[model samples]
Target: MKMDLGDQGLAGNAAAGGRPLAIEARGLIKRFDHFTAVDGVDLAVPEGAIYGILGPNGAGKTTTLRMLLGIIDPDAGLRRILGAERPHDVAHAIGYLPEERGLYPAMKAYEAIAFVGALRGLPLAEGRKRGKALLEEHGLGYAIDRQIRQLSKGMAQQVQILGTLVHEPRLVIFDEPFSGLDALNQGKLEKMIRGLAEKGTTVIFSTHVIAHAERLCDEVAIIAGGRVPFAGPVDLARDRIRPQVRLETRAEDGAWRTALPADARREGRFWNFTLPESGIEPLLRALIEGEAGILSLSIERAGLHDAFVAIAGEAAARALEEGETEERA
Candidate 1:
């Protein structure tokens, strides 16, 4: 559900009352000299929601996050985290994992996690205690004493994820958090992201990899050339892109589905076509006669991959504008 930004706090994220907004941004804009990296952006996330930010490279996502973290200031806009001014005042309530993750290579894994917790204002003793528990929970307890360098790449990635949550913040933002992991580790992290949101902590993460965001975020904002092309529930995002649907007639061998239209693109024994919202009635009739060889048929909605391509294509055009301007200059 969309959250109202009338109040902002962990509780403000709730759909109503002083409920938490998890995270909310309004009129968010940032620029570099003559260029705008992020145009006007607005986002609303309720408590216990997993929201994703999707955009092509140079879409101003990083800049937006940086401004929220107070690492940089936006030229215009407002950001609220757990109901407070972000970064400077709201730092304690937010956990952040940047796209470029790093840890002290020589530090012990446990120590690094604790150190992160401490930075978030947790006491050393408590941080260490919780840090160990987090590591163990993520299947990293054995690596507590190991140097960060000693851990494999995925292990180190897990440590970073653990550290991001050590302070128990009400909101967490992870950028490209799944970039380098293998399938197993990716699944593990996906579960963890869901678990975090389930516990009333709003989660927002960014990725160029649309599938990860598609499966994770309850709502997403796709930006291009610093502007929002689509924002809202993932379903809405897919709808906004409005790509073709694929109907796979799972038939085998030489015999084709007599009912299927001749226009479908064939893959192996299957033919694919988009089922229009109005109805697939006309097409269904065509498929009936061809139904003899039809083993099965399924309608698959346009996935996030298609959404990204559709949305990003517009962004690419806007970014290309800059090149044209520069050449003219």
Candidate 2:
């Protein structure tokens, strides 16, 4: 069956520059009894961009996503999806993959994929056709007729992802999409996300893994303890932390020692410290003039991990590190 194309107007509006924001939430708050889960979070996702919501476990990322999807209403906030104040009418234009995975064990892979598409306003026959094409394109052609229980965990995930995109939604939302996949599968998913953006689909996903956000997101919001401390381009977040300089020299006792920044720490013949606002040229000149034999010197630029540690605090950074360690184990 042919799918209704009513929601195509939303995508056209974006192409025509009617509204640049595909998703927006302002002052969103959620409370469970006396305890608040989400606190005054604001978000803006540009059309055709891959946006990431990054936070440690229990940082209210899922709650914020649910509210934005209209699966649950926020106690205080305004949210718009595809320019609609309420998402109900535009629900069919969006595709979502929840953190939790579910499927009938006995269902065939194709049927499962098609069923999800049907729910997204795709007709069963059309869903099946598209599902088959997606599976084959993703290298799962042999598994189409196989039962869900017969497939491996990674294969099952690909089927689910195909289901999410079968209806060709304009905006795709994935909550913790890479939680359980192995490294290879995770890499594949990353490529798939980029491909979606290339095709003009707005993508938003929540993750605790900073590496994914660092590699995939055009912009990210960092949330911790139910509040967002930073949100914007990845480069802006990295700017929150200072760059470090590492130096090793044969001559230790000289004007170079005095020229070192107050925060500098010496470890044997090496010195590690952040660059001063005055810059490194003066320090380099002092080292040379002081007869300090500079064996090697290198500057280390700040990364997303460093930015997270600075903006979210040591406690939240520690939590994220612990989570990654657990995932690896």
Candidate 3:
């Protein structure tokens, strides 16, 4: 979807939900031995916004998420989660779903959820009650008593997701949450994320998939080579590239062709080019006056995928494609 190109603000002001930041990180760095995984990363996520950390596999997305969650201390830099400088201090208020999905095969669906909640300080009984309600609400009530191994892959994944929310956390961080789901399940997950944001829960998710971020995120950070190249509102990223113009005319050659920019490319009867800085009015006037016989004319704002390619460079974009291919395989 194309958003109107507006102010070039990062996640602040209205973009930050007019509330305090739920997460703030500055110059976060993580290293493994001599290998640097995340370098000089920074992020500002609002209290009730859905923010996405976008990058390909091996781009330090997971490492960055781990740093934010306090699962692993950053070798350098600082971070604050849910207004606490120490993420552990706010552990009970946060929910995390790691990229690696796991659930004891022998545990029943509701039991598994309660176990996870217990780890986060939610009482087992309360968790079970919430778990059953969540399952029924999400159309999984029939699977409530079934063991994890007995459920389908999609069902198991859903169970784990429910477990993540069983404690009703104020902040949720999901690393590559859509990694292995089918189309239907992916849609469900997207809806769930939106629901959380609607209820004033802050959500931060890392993913290589651009479509999800484009559709759901209010602000995003485009990371490449273990660093962020751009971080701001989705519309700002899209505005990095000018809107494209698609024009179909009956005339093969005329003064209208002269008015078209030199960068315009002709494909049969269609002429395509970047919308001129002077806008489409001048171009339309020229076409009409020159009798170009316009059959169709439309302006298309760049999508998030195109904006990502423009901001992250072709190499990083290619890496993202390769990651998607591997996921499919």
Best by TM-score: 3
Each prediction's RMSD to truth? 7.2, 6.1, 5.9
Q: Please list the C-alpha lDDT of all candidates, in the order they appear.
A: 0.74, 0.88, 0.90
lDDT at position 302, candidate 1? 72
Ranking by lDDT: 3, 2, 1
* Local lDDT at 16 for model 1: 41
lDDT of 2 by residue, 1-37 (tens): 1212243322322322354889877778889999999
The TM-score that candidate 2 achieves is: 0.88
1-329 per-residue lDDT for model 1 (tens digits): 22233443233334544545666677777778899888877777778888888765677778877877788877877777666765678788778898888999999998889988888898888988888898888788899899999998878988988988999998898877876777788899899989888888888887666667878888888777788877777886576543343554544533334444455676665567555555666656655556644456576667765766676685564453453344235
Clashing pairs in 2: none
Superior candidate under lDDT, 1 versus 3: 3
Q: Put down candidate 3 lDDT per residue, 222-321, tens digits, no spaces.
A: 9998999898899999999999999998888886788998799988778899999999999999999999999999999999999999999999999999
State every prediction's TM-score relative to the real structure: 0.77, 0.88, 0.92
